[model samples]
Target: MATQREKDAADYLQKHQIMELFDNLTSMLFFYRPDNPREFLVEQLKQLKLSKQTGVNQQNLFNNSNLDAVIRILDPANQSYITYAQYKHALTTLGIKDINESPEGVHEDKISHETFKSEAIEGLQRCSSTYIKSDV
Candidate 1:
């Protein structure tokens, strides 16, 4: 049986249309086999041409700082690499409130592959929706 938290996470992902994004990303990763998912994400953001459409600087969205942070978070084990699960977890936790500080006493900002993917997925969905709704 799924835990209440798991169910809630699923609900959140479904509510925000993040599942679609996750599925698409998963498919792309399976086919592309990028050496570094974090780098791949940066590349995707650049290819999105979001800055051109919204008049915001692309550097703000796909910079070395952000990529480094993501890489660190996604590979909490310090294994110098990440698996698909780690990638998904990092993406899912992107916008979840207090997820790093749940009543269960989870640590905030401590990157772990065990982190739920729905959390980060929510963040990605929010970004996607925001771009879609922008005047671009």
Candidate 2:
């Protein structure tokens, strides 16, 4: 049950083509050891810069021939755990012609929600025209 503000944020991210960017960042967090507070903090620092480095891809994801595969590639898009048919449905809806283009690029895609969230937040800031800035 997400709050209204949270839902709006998600919608904004999706509209800007940064959805996949956030997803990639979220997936990477799994590699860290949650039990170690120090390691957790260190990873957070490293992640702050990642989203910016990824930036929004210059090419439109929907327009690209690889979109369908990308939908499947994103681990979270499968609801953080999804079935193959769900992946197939996305490809079908996106009208992706080739089924196997390798969506490695689309893996982790989201804003890495956090107030101190820097790089990703900054990356989204640069592309602010896509959302947060758009409201202004």
Candidate 3:
């Protein structure tokens, strides 16, 4: 049986979206592999604070730079594209769950970086709005 304190801690984490925040932080850290992770984290946290203060919905927490990094990581051969499956996996990793198909005119078998970015941006916005709706 779980203790009350443990249950409360879990509730707190979920309520504050701490786990999702940590997941994004860890993913970005690994993707960048920066020389100074602490400094990187500080910048990211500052952005997060600014966004929150501005009432910006950033639940999915993805940016153009991160999207580009994801494409590069998935397309290790410098092909400038990734398989549809890889694109889907990348979206899932970025906490984007609402996008089931590529953006219009994108080939499923060979998704270009631009197409992926479009779909990712759409999905991120949708997911962030969903969070806002749920919270209200």
lDDT of 1 at 32: 73
RMSD to the hidden true structure, all candidates: 15.9, 14.8, 5.5
lDDT of each: 0.50, 0.40, 0.73
TM-scores of the candidates in the order shown:
0.29, 0.23, 0.56
Which of candidates 1 and 2 reaches a greater lDDT? Answer: 1
Q: List the residue pairs that clash in candidate 2.
A: 20-109, 21-110, 22-109, 22-110, 23-108, 23-109, 23-110, 24-108, 24-109, 48-119
Model 1 scores a TM of 0.29
Question: In model 1, how large is the Cα lDDT of residue 34?
Answer: 93
* Number of the candidate with higher TM-score, 1 or 2: 1
lDDT tens digits, residue span 6-98, model 2: 999988866754654444334434444367756754554354444345543322223223433444464445443333444445444543334
lDDT of 3 by residue, 1-136 (tens): 9999999999987787776667667877887898999999888776677566666764455688978787878997979778888888888887787776745444548887888898889877765442332232
lDDT assessment of candidate 1: 0.50
Best by TM-score: 3
